[model samples]
Target chain A: MAGKAVPNATRRSERSHRAILDAALELVAEVGYPKLTIEAIAARAGVGKQTIYRWWPSKAAVLLDAFVALGERAAQEAEGPGSEAPYAFPDTGDLEADLKFVLRATVDELLSPTYDLPYRALAAEGIVNPEIAAEFVSRVMEPSVQLYVERLRAAQQAGQVAADLDPRVAVELVTGPVTARWLLRTLPLTHAYADAVVEMALRGLSPR
Target chain B: MAGKAVPNATRRSERSHRAILDAALELVAEVGYPKLTIEAIAARAGVGKQTIYRWWPSKAAVLLDAFVALGERAAQEAEGPGSEAPYAFPDTGDLEADLKFVLRATVDELLSPTYDLPYRALAAEGIVNPEIAAEFVSRVMEPSVQLYVERLRAAQQAGQVAADLDPRVAVELVTGPVTARWLLRTLPLTHAYADAVVEMALRGLSPR
Candidate 1:
């Protein structure tokens, strides 16, 4: 049914691309962002440095791609095979329950060692490196963050949230605490934590 | 500081210690964390390697001290000299106003490039290295964080915050958004942002 047959050369190149990305992810986790190098990545991937250079602009670029790929893989695993839709914050009529559902999944993802290691590396680099930080936010973080924003907007319309509230900032009430606990690790990142955050966000901390 | 001080020797050692911390901060900002080293810090500080090792355990430790020193300096500058009390969250009896004041101050600190660069480096390293992270949290972050817990507790007693909520987790509602905004740079870290976070946290985002 296809117009053209896939060439062996193209397929081999695709394999090398995936291998290079995987190698980049592993090396960053093992040695950290400071020690990771193109040569090490090349050796680990069994590819020439030139091949990598032909595609990615730098080591951080490659790692960002790898991180995205890993996140996509995680998302795919959650939804079963061939799922292409990005993560959506649930919109059950009960806003608190939906938020708790999403934030709890987020807590689980952030605490996982496999994702956590490479993410920490990338995030650390992003903090100091403005260029990478911007890209990481726009490309990787913002999309998911927007999911929360959209859900908040919907809740506001449903009269679960105040109509005048900025959905962007309101989303932060739930997400910010989740993120803080997740990043700081001062307290346990648990479903209980997510529930607390959602309840606080919805009920307000003041005596109601 | 107490009993057995040889004035000249003690003063000189203190000077050298300050110099090492200053150098550590400067180099981390300039080269980023990955390139920072003990030798470089020594050279920058005009001290020998032994001088540094005599005082701090590692480059990370030195930076942590430097960051804390910088923060203390900022706090002192804000309150004027001879202010012994660390930054206490304002207990103006208006919970929203007090939180807004502190979070606004936090926004300014995070956005200012002077503290931001070195802070970013340390935070990045802390993410990957659990040892440094724990120390950074316990030593640098926790004291200020405790201020929030105390303030929230006061609010609870005063009939401001809901008594059932965990003050520890509730604090995250204020902190998380500030941190997420600061770290991501997806939005401007500003007073307005702090105001929004405080409003959302206190009033609840839902129709109240």
Candidate 2:
């Protein structure tokens, strides 16, 4: 009877964990990050505030985990079942085509309503909060950026990219414009814009 | 007697205006944007909250004006007395040299503690508030970006840049990476980093 109770307890804990994360995302979307509270997250998740405190130190931690989980779920769906490495960068022989394909997908993801609100809220919070900013840079940004670095290194090995070009800095030439346009709202982020960015970065802005 | 009284009134109003702008900037730096209030700004400026309300509709308005005023003040100092067009882009006929100069200055300004906190707070606020974002893009971002466009156009005419390129999009290739590195804090923003970005954009990433 005691062994049966332990399995039941584990299942209940897992259910509560999912509920809390979902609630945090939903509340941030509705109220924005400044107004989001652990108390509110608890109320919506139907869990005690103490339960949240026991698991996470602050609202930022909860939100960060929720976002990371969302990304994992997205990757799993995109890769389909039985894929262990869903986050791998596509490395077709053509660097330009590979970059364009990935960037276009990014443009779509950034503009999607499913990811926009919660992500924007957290991003805004990170901007003003140094601790959150450090966490975000390390956990969310560095990992994704590393994918591009790996792809660029592979391209260099193929002699498609300039041998001396730092893959890290070179990656910025392709990724930064899309991000700046999206963040600053200076122009509409489009597939065409992504394609143009890749073309310019590859071909050079100077007259060939 | 009437003329003298009018001049005195104008002087008093100007003093109050400067005071309010200074207070708003200082308070935002200390408390962050989410907690900034008109009442606090009023008290710090030694004026009633009604005075702030009369001049601006909200705290965001006061903060925006304060930032604009700071930029104007900086421009005046940089350009010196009796300069009408202080905001013009530097065009030395060498596109690489000109871009490197301006971007290096920008790196200095971004890393300055005086500009860093308040500017970042406003930028963070703009991320979550569409209304603020639109206003900022128009009032702050667009104007500075247009300077780059004008310089790039000059380069195009001089046969330095590719004539077929769009100045607006091409400008992003130069500016986007620096802005991304600064905002995301993924790497240290430095003069060397800015120089590398300009060099890479000019030379192209593909082998000659």
Candidate 3:
């Protein structure tokens, strides 16, 4: 579906797309994923249902796009201008600091009331819906996970990370704990928690 | 609420409680959480709804107990017989090997279709419902998370883990990754993945 409607997507179409995404997120936060409907999203966006359907096949698809856009925007805003890549991990020759930065940002986002409700709505849907879960893994989650994998590979090449470790699996070692803490939620999420995760991940759990 | 129930739990009451829990699990799996009802549970268990309410305050309470019982049984079976505790981590003075064993079993449980469906149902409920989420963390999740904390502290005293590390947060260093890998299903959950998490967590990601 890439570039299938590029000619159709004039500047006005981009405005409408953002409006629909915003509307979808608003409605999901208000009523949750189970009750969110295409009609409501279109009405709230001041667009017709046909317009929403023309761009995305389902509400879940629209939400997938909405969250991806939201995450990227958050990442870009956090990184500031003149950065090489928005979501890519920084390589100042310090893997621990870089990981903590990204994870702390994640903690902030997860703790934000605005992001929390809608994301949880989508996550609830994803838990039951296989199609949405697959789309999330491939389109949203995997790409983000891959960024860390890329950064870890860079660390390996720089001789900071162990050469024998698989970067993909190693990425999970950090991401897993952070996401688990967020998802399960027995304690308040903080930069301190993120720092600990980074330290334990970098300097082994055994005595340094 | 704990030992007090033993005096009231005649063989008949014990049988009734089991039936209700079973009915709740079956109904949740069959129709999902939103549709599950005490009336339905009562009908399925061949008991009156009053009988259920007499023991548990709500459907959520019944489900929490149901899941707890299920988890304990699984842990007991996995640990073999004569273990000091059902869900407690084994300390053969080898933190890495012991962690891998528990994590591998977790991988097996997460991958099981029976456990997967009901858990997803309850977890989906927990995600949106604040009260249920709190109950889940305090009751279901924390008990198990504490076990890891205990094991980690044991390692710390033995010099197998860092002296300065917080066992509570350190436990997430491993649990976080395993749950994330399970919750976000881009990769297959397996013993190999569990082993990778264990190794990275204990040995650190750096060249050392």
True contacts kept of each: 0.86, 0.74, 0.84
lDDT (tens digit, per residue) of candidate 1 on B1-208: 5665678778888898889888988898788877899999999988899988887888888898899988888779989888765686789899999999899888887777788877777777777677888888887778888999999999999998998989988888888888877766667888888998888888888796
lDDT of 1 at B114: 85
Weakest 10 consecutive residues, lDDT, candidate 3 chain A?
A: A81-90
lDDT of 3 by residue, B49-107 (tens): 99999888878788888887777777679787666554767789888899999999888
Candidate 3 CAPRI-style tier: medium
Local error of candidate 2 at residue A175 (angstroms): 0.7
Q: Which of candidates 2 and 3 reaches a greater DockQ?
A: 2
Question: For every candidate, how close is chain A to the native chain A in TM-score?
Answer: 0.90, 0.93, 0.82
The candidates, ranked best first by lDDT, are 2, 1, 3
Residue by residue across A134-195, what tens digits does model 2's lDDT show? 88888788887999998888888988899999889999999999878887778899999999
- Which residue pairs in candidate 1 have backbone atoms (N, alpha carbon, C) closer than 3 angstroms, thus clashing? none
For model 2, name the residue pairs that clash.
none
- Interface RMSD of each candidate, angstroms, one decimal: 1.2, 1.1, 1.4
Tell me, by TM-score, which candidate is best: 2
Candidate 1 vs candidate 3: the lDDT winner is 1
> Against the true structure, what is each candidate's TM-score?
0.92, 0.95, 0.84
Binned by DockQ into CAPRI classes (incorrect, acceptable, medium, high), candidate 1 is medium
lDDT of the candidates, in the order given: 0.84, 0.87, 0.82
